[model samples]
Target: MAAACGLTAAATMLPLVLGGGSGDGARPGGRPLAQAPPAKAPGAVPAKAETCTDPEASLQPSSADGPTIDRIKKAGHLVVGVDQNSFRWGYRDPATGRLDGFDIALVRAIAKNILGSESKVTYRAIPTNQRIEALQEGKVDIVVRTMTVNCERIKQAAFSTAYFQAGQQVLAPKGSPITGYNDTLKGRKVCTATGSTAYDALKAKSYGAVFADTATAQRTVPNQLDCLVKLQLGLVDAVVTDNALAAGQAAQDPAVDLKGDPFTTEYYGVATKLGNDDLVRRINQVLVDYRKGGNESPWMKAYRRWLAADLKGITGPPAPKYR
Candidate 1:
């Protein structure tokens, strides 16, 4: 995903420290934090009438149902998992020390509809690999970490409708002769994140591009300023990564440029724990509303504000399949 709004770890850490308690505040030592008092057996009637009101009263219309929504209502807040390192999609604001990005806008919209306040959102910065695991373990209520929804991931978690469309692109020095996927990569070394789909796709194509398993393709460069630094320094020939990320790298350094068209398409989705239909439905409803009336909602406004400026010729939300 492109780094439009900047969701950085240092930005998210401020909220974590202010909120207090260990991450998630779940029970320690492999036990529930506080077990509920023994309750009457199933089919038994309650002794007193329940006083809590339906929190969904304020939510927009939706047919989907699940426990994720209920949990957020009960807790009076929404916990969203996101990536801090990716520049446009998510990153930290050095000035405010808070997490904000295109995905963060969606999280705020959902929080406003559910909690009636945007401040109800609790941002959790997670590594790319931990996005699904965090949701599965109940460490977060939702994962907005630019996750791609595929059949395999579906088995582990439910997904909201697609919100972004992306594809793989190669990053190389500005004046390199390599221009497209068909170019000879036999002797060129490519840097990509370990276990990333980009690696698999490149390998499947038998491109003969050497692979460097780094934590983030952006960091594989010798310095933070230029992804082409390695190539300039003769450390590597090119960097293979997503087009959006490649755009970020090019924007950061004039010496680098994206080569050719994207190699593969990737759809971005919000991830929830497996079987958490309620939360997923609620989020889907928000997306539906945002895309309604042929109007750009606040979420899209934020997205455009941060993303459009950097990705020239790219504007508005992704297509229906991606939205």
Candidate 2:
């Protein structure tokens, strides 16, 4: 039920100009980018504590044959919720007009395993804010849209093992003096999509009380990529998103670059409906068995083709740990 062309219109995006791109972007664990993560702002209410299993913590395998499998087998297709503007994670390729990215690659593999055809699936383009609610509402069978696992989300939905590692970071114009996650944001307006970790990070004490009584970037959008549009239009000073996503945006627009070290480490997981532990277990096993083919693994091939350059040094799937 997915028309690749329709995803282009649904995705809130900034048109990319791919010419004369630079190779001098930031890299993790090496020459640092931006400033060291700032200390927690004094007396600012801390980010919500995750008292439950971390959303992206390592995932262990499980025997998944159950009703969920029977349901999918009966339907003969997988319905997946994903982002269309997340650049290399999940996006509509302007040239080919097809949905592609690292996450899309995973969807194809899961589809192949369950439905016997990689393309035997329906794509539901969901915004970041609606990811969990869509699952809870029974609107989709799986979500692979750079979703972070956290205690609050587990209350409503289930998540697969950690699939990708990410961290909250800043994006800004080429020569802006905003160094790292520091005072450079005093009078600056930043943008983040609603229902995102980046939005939550902005409110956390350490990243400056962005939403505090003080002056900060007060704008919120429906999609994280829209923040980049605000920056392009000079509507906001910068955009805050995961470094992984910012890397893709930077590639799309040479005018912007990742400005600082990622302030917090996070992980991305596949999300499914609550009480769908059978499906959850099945997905986790899929992840565990994804790369056994070694050099022929689809995960490696896609990463090398799309993500290796932007996310320097990433070479393999995240190791899984079972609960």
**Best model number under TM-score:** 2
Q: At residue 92, what lDDT does model 1 achieve?
A: 72
Clashing pairs in 2: 34-260, 35-180, 55-149, 55-150, 59-321, 59-322, 60-321, 60-322
TM-score of each model, paired residue for residue: 0.73, 0.81
Report the Cα lDDT for residue 188, model 1: 73
Total clashes for model 2? 8
lDDT of each: 0.59, 0.70
Q: Give a tens-digit lDDT track for model 1, residues 243-282.
A: 7666765665566787776665566678888677677678
Regions of candidate 2 where Cα sits further than 4 Å from its true position: 1-60, 206-218, 293-296
> Candidate 2: worst 10 consecutive residues by lDDT?
25-34
**What TM-score does model 1 achieve against the real structure?**
0.73
RMSD of each: 14.5, 11.1
For candidate 1, give the lDDT of residue 199: 56
